[model samples]
Structure formats: structure tokens, C-alpha cells
Target: MRVERLVPLALPRGQKLQCELCRGPAGLRCGACCVTYYCEVEHQKADWDSIHEKICQLLIPLRTPLPFYNSDKERNHGLEQQLSREKHLVELTHRVAQKFLFEGKHKEAIPAALHSLRFSIHIYGLNSVELVPPYLILAEASIGLGHLTQAEEYLSQAQWTVLKTSHCSDAIQSKLHRNLGLLYAAKGNFEESLYHLANDIYFASCAFGTNNISSSGGYYHMANVFFRQNKMDIADSLYSEATDIWHSYFSGLIDVQLQTIMSPSEIDILCLPALRFHSMELNTIFIPSADESQQAEASQILNAILDIREHASRQQPMKTGKVVHALAMLHYLILDIPKAHELAMKALLIISYLQKQDSAEAIQQLINLIKSKPFYAK
Candidate 1:
């Protein structure tokens, strides 16, 4: 019997990602996933003869031109054509994005993920389990690009989306929390990371059973976080536990059912972006009259956005400081005088790091906007 899938294939390691068999420095890769490498045609052919042929047809390509779904009049119902288009668009787009991400081409992956995010929201809606995979992929890609705050938002959305569906298994829930833990760790918030990691361990244990080898992955990560925090005793114990689990599995009591499944990022096609708003409608705000509560709510939203901008300044100071400063003016316009002053101060803090003249001008203009207010007349 042949292997039923071409994916989840592991590549041999070298200075570069290497050939599966020869272990030679290689460049030519399998077109399907762009992962498997070959030193020469002979080695490639040999590998295929040995194992690849069994699973080749089951493999999804890393990237491909978008597939057009044909729905002529005979098969076209009101929504049939629309669903067909959405399915092909989302699936193919996801594949392309995953390819970029796997290759560590983070800059290239970002746009692909952004495009898929929009498609996921439209195709799966807010409540579907289908939304979790792309949301997690977008989060991972965002993390790769050092967009920690964007990653946090994506993780939150993933959690919310998962909660909206009862179909998600404990393993998936564990996976989501694991990413959250990792995200918080990246942001230098180890407390949140440990909490999430612990939850991941718990859920994974529940899903895979206490003695299953697959549950050790969660133990390994949790140990890793503890190791990072310099809690040697705890880390040592967790590491030992993971080792014991693996040793037991190597002794041949492993459960095939407990192995991790291929996530959506691994197998699906890409997603096409869906337009959320009309260009004209976005430019026009309909809230002409605001009550006191509305004003307070708006100020709260501005505050959260300000926090994101401040964090963003660390990565893209010139661009973010300008936006933060402008948002400060908006804060003042909304009569949130204190918040506006804080936002202005935060932007100015970033300005000390910016080397651009235009960025300085934008910050100055933001200052002028705040100072022109009667409250700042002194």
C-alpha cells in the first residue's frame, strides 16, 4: 500500500535546506511544496521511486495561479457561482501565502496573509471553524514580520472565531493557545505566555490522552518558556518529562491517532481579499451627532489605537509617529484633551529616534494642532 498523502514530508537539513536523500547542497526543489530539494535529477528520480511516487498526487503546490471555477448556466444558481468562486479563491491564495511563509520570505508573505484574512472573514464568516486556520497563519506571518500587535489582534480574532464554533477539537484549541503563548513571549510578556502555554498543555493532554507521545510537544514548549525565564528546576523537570514521553514512544507504544493533523496553512489554496467597505462610504462618517457616552466610547477606541501606534513606533518610527500625532489631533477634536496630550507626548518620544525631515514636520504639525486648542493656550 502506498502513502495516502505527499505532505507532512520532512526534508533533510544542511547549511541550506537540503536534498531528501543525497544530503547535498542543493537548489532545485519539488515544485509542489517547494520544500523537497534535489542535488540532481538522478537523486530526485531515486527518491521518487523510493517514496515520493506514493504521495506525489496528494500534494498541494506551494503557489500557483488562481484557479477559476467555471459555473455555466446549467449549474449556476443564485449563490452557487459565488460560493464556487470564493472556494477556489480562498483555497489557492492560502497555498501561496503558506509557501511564502515557509520559505521565510516574510515580507512577501505579509500581503498574501492580509489578502487571505479578508477572504476568510467573508468566506467563513465570523462564526465558522474554517476561519481559525487563516487567522492563525496571518498571526504567525505577522509575528515573522515583527508586527507583534497585529499578531495579537489576529490571535484574539482566532480565539473569538474558535469560540463561535463547537466543531473545533481540543487539539485545535491547544494549538491556538500555543500560538498565543508564543506571541506573548515574543512581546516580552512571559506571564501571559506561560498561562497560555499551560492551557495548551492541558488541552492537548485532554485531546491526546495523558500517555500519548504527541502531548509532549506542549510540554517541550512550556519547558522552553521556563528555560527562557531561567527557572532551571521547572525546565529540567518538563524537559525530562518530554524525554520520557518520546522514549516511551520510540519503544513503540505510540498512537497514530494522537499525532498532530496538518493545519490549514499546510494544505489549502490561497484566499482572495474581500472588500469590506465602499471607497466613498469609508471616506464619509455618518455619525453627525454624538452623545456623551458616544464621546467616551470614541475616546476609548482612540486610546487603544494610540497604544498600538506607540508600540509600532519601535519598528517603523517615522511612519507610526506621524500617524500617532495626527490621531492626537483627532483626540483633541473629540474633546479628549488629556488623551490627546498623552498621544502627542508619545509621538514626540518616537520623533527623537526618527531621522527624516518630513516626519519631523508631521510631528510639528501635530504639536501645532494640540497647542492651538484653548486648553493648551498657556
Candidate 2:
């Protein structure tokens, strides 16, 4: 944890320096060089020249410290430590973008998504399923910004990366399939989308179990394809199925605190399919208000898990736009029109800068929405 404990760049040769902590042999060699482990000054003086001397100036700043993996437990711990930071940043970025998208402020989320993508590259590498998430976020933001072509381009890039990787983790593959299906759906290739989504569902079922939260996402996405095509009955059925999966998952994880299982963000992810399904049921296709009760229940569960306030607070600059957007929409839904307007405008500004690759419908919708709003009156 302390970079200072590391071998310093400037150390004289041959003086018998050894770390008091890990007991690792010190690289420095000087009679004055000494390493000690203590907090109080009294202890320092006693060990002065014995160990304290070498420890005094070995410290330096390290922006990206490689995980210290001297043992299996250490390696796992180190990875967990590194993963914690990265996950925090990624979650923050994703929340912002999600906020933007939910609020119909797609344009603003683009930049934040792009920045998140860089971190993702570091974590998942270029040709892994992990790339799918950041790419999909970017593509969606592009669509919001009226850069349909750019959205498509990023989606294609993600798909290519997924396919190219030989041994993708099941989680990654499921996510990739779900995203690809969504991409194809956006392009009006319903059948193609369905095919990919089916694959996503299959993989998800295997990865997370048939009744797992991960499986729900693919089912929910496939339902979107049917809904968009005006196959309301089929869409409704699929939505119901997805909801069942979520309900089962909720039952499974309900007693476990968010942090206890994986992390808060991971738990949030576990609930995402239900949240998304609720969104679809509420807005997209014309489902009777008779199901309003179900929507409310779903909303309550999703809200408790998603916790937009936390998501927004932790969001990174790379993903600030999207979090803002999602928050704006939630505000709008609650009748906080002013906040919604502000978020929508920010999303537009960001979207204007991205390439429109794969989302003609989304792009046009954003444009039309903005033009209709009083904020664009000037």
C-alpha cells in the first residue's frame, strides 16, 4: 500500500538494508541505510541506522502502482484492490451516461462514455467482451447526439473485438451478444438482433444460471426487438419472462447486502434488466395502464438498487455527461422540468461532437425532441 516501501531509485551500494515489514532484502546498500516499521518517533530513534534510516527517503508518488502479487492471496487481494478503483471509476462514468440516456439527453453522455472506454481498454484489453460495454455506451450516446453512423461504427468495432478474442469470459460474451443484438435492433435488423440476443441469453443462462440477473438482460433486449416491430403480444410475453428472471434473482440476493456480494455497482448491475424492462414497459410500446401496478413495483425495486444519487456522485468526468442525463430524466419524470432541461442541453452539446454511426431513429428522435422543447427556442 505504501509506495515508499519500494526500492528507491537512489540508494548507495552495500550496507545491509532489509525491510522490517515484509522482511524482503532491501536493494539499497549503505551503512546509513536502514528500514523500519513504526509510527512513533521514539521507536524511530531506537531503530535509527538499524532500519529507519533507509525508510526515510524511499517514498515517491505512483499514479498507477502495479498490484503486488507475492502470493496467491496477495495476488487476489491486489487484483481486488486494483479492480475496486477501476470499478468505482467505471461505475461513476456509466451512471452519468445512463442518466443522460434515460433523460433522452443522449448527446451529452458521449464524452463520458469515451473516457470510460479508455479505462475499460486497460481492464479488458482491446479484443475482449469487456469492450462491449463501453462501446455500447458510446454508441448509444452517439445515437442521442444524432451521430447514427458513429454509433454503428463503435458497435461494429465492439462486435469485431468480441469475435476476434478466442477465450472470452462467459460474462463478457453474454454482454457482447446482448449489445450486438441491441445494435442490430437499432438498425432495424430485427431478426439479426434477435439472433444475437438469443445467443446472449444462452450464454448468460450458462454463466449466471437460468434464473440469474445476467440472463434477464438478453431476454429484455430481445423483447425490445419485438416491441419495436410492433409485435406487442410477443414483446409483452418476453418482458414478462425477463421480469420473472429478475424476480427470481431478487429473491436470491435480497437478504445479502449490496457490498457483501460483489459491490454496490455489481448489485446495481444485477437489477439493471428489471429497470430496463420497466422503462420499456412504461414508454416504448403501448402496454395498457392495467399493468401500471407492475410498473410501480418494478420501479420501487429498481430504484432501491440503482440509487441514482450514488451513481451520480461517484461518476467520473469521462462519464459525467451520461450520469447527468439519466438524473435529468429521473427529475423530469418526477416533474422537475428545469433539471431535465439542463441535462438535456448538456447531452446535446456532447452528442454534437461525436460521429453518428448506427442510430438513425435515435438521432432523429433527439433532434425532434430538442426542437420541440422551449430550451431550443433561442
Q: lDDT tens digits, residues 237-274, model 2?
A: 67556555544433333223123333445444335443
TM-score of each: 0.41, 0.44
Model 1: ten consecutive residues of lowest lDDT = 269-278
Instruction: lDDT for model 1, please.
Output: 0.57
In model 2, the number of clashes is 34
lDDT of 1 by residue, 208-240 (tens): 888565456566667777878878677656755
lDDT of 2: 0.53
Candidate 1 regions exceeding 4 Å error are 1-73, 76-119, 166-168, 211-214, 243-378
